[model samples]
Target: MTAISLPSAMEFIWLEADLLDSHDYAAWLALWTATGHYIIPTERDAEDYAAVLNVVYDDQEMREARVKRLQSGLSMSASPAARTVRTVSRFRAMDGAAGVFVVRCAQHIVEYKYDRTRMLAADVLFWLVPAASGISLQRKVVTLINGDDALHGIGYLL
Candidate 1:
């Protein structure tokens, strides 16, 4: 198992958020492994992934397609490019078996564009491994604080 420090793990998470906020899709995509998944479930306490409806469940292919759309300048939602500021806190890391690390953090993001500001909050979990380029995400799960409520035009990464 590759030994990775907790501080290093936190740094990696911070950098990921920064990249997303900066709309650096290429860099953000590079932080994930080929088989990584991004999940946002509709149920706040949902455990069975296959049973409940999901707000977003993006695999590698889906992620790539989304990035492609974002880069192509064809996504109307991103035409004005909502500028975002993300605050990640309460970051903690745990060692998983087989050299994997589980990172948990709370995130609050404020987005402004289209003449309106929106705030989103969530608890995020990341399964990561120490890879050649520092850390690679194996899975990312985000449970919105108000997952059961209505959300509008969530076309960008959170």
Candidate 2:
């Protein structure tokens, strides 16, 4: 049985970040398990995400729809998606349920569009399950540093 090392987990995270930064949504989507959820909570300390209002809480179907919308030319916010560069670091890993790994990290993103640049920082957590190929994301939660504040133009994947 192959074990998940910190370095390997971090590598996967970096790959995911790269995919998002490049707007390679299709490849990014392939990183998840069929039941995976992508979440961005409205509250920084939110525990039960399902009970609280969230900025994004997408399952497989919703994720697919979101990707389509971003790729389509219709949605105003997504029409010209903001260009983004993301840095992810400060990784910590621990075993969760049997055959599951939980990883936590810090992520900072710089987005530029319309000649303006904005920064976004967040604490990110991931639940990973080993797959035949390598590892698959079971859940991803991103809690923004200023989740409660008024924010705009986050049309691209973070």
Candidate 3:
């Protein structure tokens, strides 16, 4: 097996962020392998694999369904869609068994409407599986800093 370089891993992360920031949902979904998981935790201490209080959990099918909903104009809240800006910082990498690695980063997302603005800060953990097509996401786990408070709606991608 070939080793995954840090630069390549960072590139994949940058690409993923660009796709999300651009609202290219279909392109974003295509980046995931079939068994990929997306998670946003409601509790900081909760393990993503075992947690029940997730804000969003999606396997491939569920992700596809979400994309379909967005594309079909079924998402009512998208009207005058919320604007979002995200900055990812402080990237750290942890070596996993075999060829996989876990990348951790701090993310700050600012979302706004006409008069309402909300800021979300989170620690994001990504399982990076080295593939022929570069690094594919095995899992994405987000732990919000403000998990205790009621979050305003996230109508767009973070």
Candidate 4:
């Protein structure tokens, strides 16, 4: 099998991060495959995918519903939305089976509201499949350093 180029993988990471940081939720959601899974793990061992809470696990239709809710102006929790900035670094490619290319990285996400600022550090595993348009996400597993702590949930994508 031909190896996926580093530049190609990095480019995908850059584009994905840009879409997420810019809060282009619809465009971002469109990039996932039909069976894609979004998981945020409570522990560091995200490779043990069995131990995680899935924040977004949707087919195309369910993903569309989520986007619709965000756009309807009915999500009151997002009225005074928090500002978010996510920085992803230290990307490394990994070999895997199942026609998926895996990229591991570290992420620092900072979110700020009027009176509160929350910082999150996580190890991110991005499982991607090459698609006609670009890379389609198969799974995005984020293992937060402090996943079990009490924190307010941001209404939008993280």
Per-residue lDDT tens digits for candidate 3, residues 11-119, read 7877888787677898898788889888887777764445476787888898888777666766767655677778887888876766678888888988888798889
Using lDDT as the yardstick, the better of models 2 and 4 is 2
Candidate 4, superposed: residue stretches over 4 Å from native: 1-3, 43-61
Q: Candidate 2: what lDDT? A: 0.90
RMSD of each: 1.6, 1.2, 1.8, 2.7
Per-residue lDDT of model 1, residues 103-126, tens digit only: 889999999987889999999998
Q: What is the lDDT of residue 23 in candidate 3?
A: 79
Clashing pairs in 4: none
Whichever of 3 and 4 has more lDDT, that candidate is 3
Give TM per candidate: 0.92, 0.95, 0.90, 0.83
For model 3, the superposed segments whose C-alpha errors exceed 4 Å read 48-51
Query: Candidate 4, which ten residues in sequence have the lowest lDDT sum?
Result: 48-57
Off by over 4 Å in 1: none
Q: Please give the distance, in angstroms, between residue 16's alpha carbon in candidate 3 and its true position after superposition.
A: 1.0
- Once model 4 is optimally superposed onto the true structure by TM-score, how far is the C-alpha of residue 91 displaced, in angstroms? 0.5
TM-score, candidate 2, is 0.95
Give the Cα lDDT of each candidate.
0.86, 0.90, 0.78, 0.75
Top candidate, metric TM-score = 2
Candidate 1 clash pair list: none
Worst 10 residues of 3 by lDDT: 44-53
